[model samples]
Target: MSQLDTAWPAGRDVPDVEKLIRQTREQEQQPVCAYIYDLVALRERAHRCVNSLPDECKLFYAVKANPDPQLIASLLPIVKGFEAASIGEIRTIRGVSGDVPIIFGGPGKKDAEIEEALERDVMLIHAESLHEVQRIGWIAERRQQRVSILLRINLRRTLPEASITMSGRPTQFGIDEIQVPEAIRLVQSLPFVQLEGFHMHSLSNNLDARLHAQMVATYLQCVQGWMQEYALSIRYLNAGGGFGISYTEPERRFEWNDFMEELHQVWEDYHIPGIQLIFEPGRYIVAHCGYYATEVIDLKTNHDQHYAIVRGGTHHFRLPVSWQHNQPFEVIAVDDWPYPFPRTEWRQTTITIAGELCTPKDVLAHEVDVEQLRIGDILLFHIAGAYGWTISHHDFLSHPHPHFYYINGT
Candidate 1:
């Protein structure tokens, strides 16, 4: 098959994922299909995120997104802490760094998870419901240890436009706004549960930076009002991260520089001396650092539509199918055709890339126009670091797992 040109971001001196894919193909004896990560890019992104934030703002990586040990370790020095959604995540963070802070947050926390979080001495446990608060208080009282927590509030305000809305509606995530007073009263009565602040994480996969700044403003205002009305001395405002990475349009990204400037203005206008702002972002911090490279196993045309079937499918990387969007990809033409038969190829045609699964829904990219592709070509899906492997149904077809490699930063 003929070689195809790959597009790189203009004027950005970043180590490209294409180079890594090529290197993997050359080294692997078998057909190369793996999830490769660039530690250099991950570290650079983490450093940029930390440096751009206001002095009062702290960046925390939510471990639910790409909990690979190496990825977590690479980000340890730059990020202030980690936001773990489960006990397993807490353990994962601890396995990487024993001293690094961890905040446990998620709905439907079992008693065992709470006990483990307390044992680990996590920085904060985001209490989602009144029952959870009481459970924590009970556990802490039984253990005779005072524990600090932030109440996850599902605010009544309408959320900004986002791919997923976790709050501002009836959801299993956090406590409703109307019940905050009752929760606070319950917390006050509990001897061991100390209310540190509020955790208002409302959105997921949000792309608009301006809207994010406005959301931050609203959170700060709501917290300020609560502080005044209840005579409460809050210490932290955990605005859970919803920063997005564009899978459809790579150029259309979250404007971090502009958002940071606006965040600084918000801090200056609503400056609270002791209250610290926490942002636990999972997808944005590591999404661009990962790439999933799958070699084309077969090429064909069905009813005038071109199709490229890869060795891996939604079982290995499910983001595109999960979000129902065309995942951005680039074709790397491999000229080595060992077969005696002539290699068939498609030129300047739209192709639907699917996996070797029984169901027809195992599509990665649906009808994406490509310059050229062939049976031996490799399609590298970018921005796949977070929510790719962990969220996939790996054992659905009992297919062999994909290889994983990390490119250590030079």
Candidate 2:
């Protein structure tokens, strides 16, 4: 059992799910697959996440994680703002978010996107490269306005225990740290762009609290030195969110208190008047508020290996496949086995769970332990609120899309 006292993630007995299934079956709707998000839980989760942070910090929801209008609307009141990766995300946030600050980020931003950001007056544009800074200055100069910019710095030192490293290596994310001085010089030459601060979003999915704290400390040290070197006034230090949620061992999770305490030290050590610390957390904020449900279609033993096939495949839920890790799920035992034939019994056995697809790469959970599985049991995957449906291939094999439902938490 995972210790989730404040946040209720599992959809084992959520009312909306029962009602959704009943209504869908009543109207002869296929219970192929559907993603249910508990807005109340999401709101409460957001509160818990932001409230735990220090006053010197600001929490911004990463709209690229869910981007559901309802979810965004629920979080608007709780979060300080949103971090968007594309123009579509900005538009999506614009519909539900009123007057909330939005930060536009992404490596390959279009010229039209710069126009839209200027038109919308986004909080700032994170310049990933020198060319982007020049383009933004070009656009702002034509508009007779000065656009605030944050030079995204790819750090030279790498942090340990991160699942994915974006800024740690020389890849397409931000300006290399060695080239920061040149970028700063270019910004100074541009008349329409004002350098607000630095953005160092290095790691992704980092679980260790100590290492996470060390990464923040490193960012603070790097930014402080750069500000002193260039004689620049830094406004915002955007430490891009990379908090990790344990999918396998839930008992051993990220230590929030320890991490926050470490942040308190960093704030004291790197104290600069009026410089705000911003965190854009996506997965940690909303991952627990969603549940992906699919009905069991077939149960068989293929070549002495038990396999459980569901109505939905990796097409609808691809997080497990994307991470190359088996997603953890709980069995929602529905006793309504309608078939007449006696299903094969697999007591105390492990099975491979997959979806109904022609190819061999449609696995959702591999080698999962199951006490018993019948014809019509529902499999509910936890920690799915973040990148569950938004990142999936929805139209493979022309299968009907799954029904989406937003439910309550309590």
Candidate 3:
């Protein structure tokens, strides 16, 4: 792929990976590293994805993945809105750009959160069930205001990597497909609630672009049928965010042009006159843009096998435990010459990676190869921009979170 295609904001030459690593070490900035190039690449990818969508479609950055204020601020101008799952995120977005449209989603929202969203005039409140709709309506009515709402709908597919799913069996999230009609009726009955359209978050690790298009088509059909049967005009259709990122080697990159083409075809086939398309892409937009930099505290041999132990563990990059995601990382000394090795050989050895914590589960990678891992060496874990630091446990042995930096080239 071209550099522009791989970098965020598009069209910039990134610093050499090895060069950046050496700089970090020469500065003695242990546990203080950033994925400068990765963030750039992620933004580029996201921009391409948004540009590929039809004119009517809108892209929303799901802030739950990594709510770095700088990242959100940088994306505000490029994206249509922000998908906030918590009150803090809502407030953060508002702090960055008050006028940026906000979509309040997630289950079990606190009353204060709803009140805050209403108080701030959020663009849309995604109601996961009839109860949430009623609650939002009650809050809006007491506040003497009307709020736009979308009923979160359950889908047919469930993702294995996600903590929550709207498909397959019963889930605590969106109302079931069968109950959507009644839920719609209830939402319509509420004076302060405006039923905008349907919202569905199928799965997180959805790599198939065609499957995404198929799901959109199916959802459009369902919404069309509902609109016709109920004689109601739906204003917005939200296909909730489940875009996947490459966390493992042989990483699967999201095919933006192909996916958008398929999505456009589906949109043309099921065009709704006055409806708007909204997409919440969290991981896809930020995953590859971030990296985790940790130092090799020690090295050892277990059963005649080499292992490099770093200061961080599953507490910092938990995708390995949560999704069994094996993110690719590179190891290099601060000033040592690059050890020459064939690509095929580098890919063949088993150099197990571990973190500083004592638990065996602290392992980061297994059967990986590094030129020469030694004490004080730095390892740069790539494509960690999405859920890397935010999802990790900082309290584990009281190891403070790594420092972060944001780099954008114009």
The candidate maximizing lDDT is 1
lDDT of 1 by residue, 196-240 (tens): 999999999888888898899999999999888888987999999
RMSD of each: 4.7, 2.8, 4.6
Ranking by TM-score: 1, 2, 3
| Prediction 3 global C-alpha lDDT | 0.75
Q: How far is 387's C-alpha from truth in model 2 (Å)?
A: 1.1
- In order of appearance, the predictions have TM-scores of 0.95, 0.94, 0.89
The clash count of every prediction, one per candidate, is 0, 0, 11
Ranked candidates, highest lDDT first: 1, 2, 3
Q: Write the per-residue lDDT of candidate 3 for residues 1-410, one digit (tens) a residue.
A: 11224323321333455556566666754543444434455566667777778879999999998898888877877899899999999989999997999999998998889998888879999898788888998999999999999888875554344444566567787888888779988988889889889897777757666677778888888899899998888799998778655566344655565577788789989989899989998987877677677877666778898777787878877877667656677765544433474211222446888887768888778877665655666777776777767787868888766655555654
TM-score: model 1 vs. ground truth: 0.95
Best by TM-score: 1
Task: Summarize candidate 2's per-residue lDDT along 122-188 as a digit string, tens digits.
Answer: 9989999998999998999999998999999988886765777888787799999999899999999
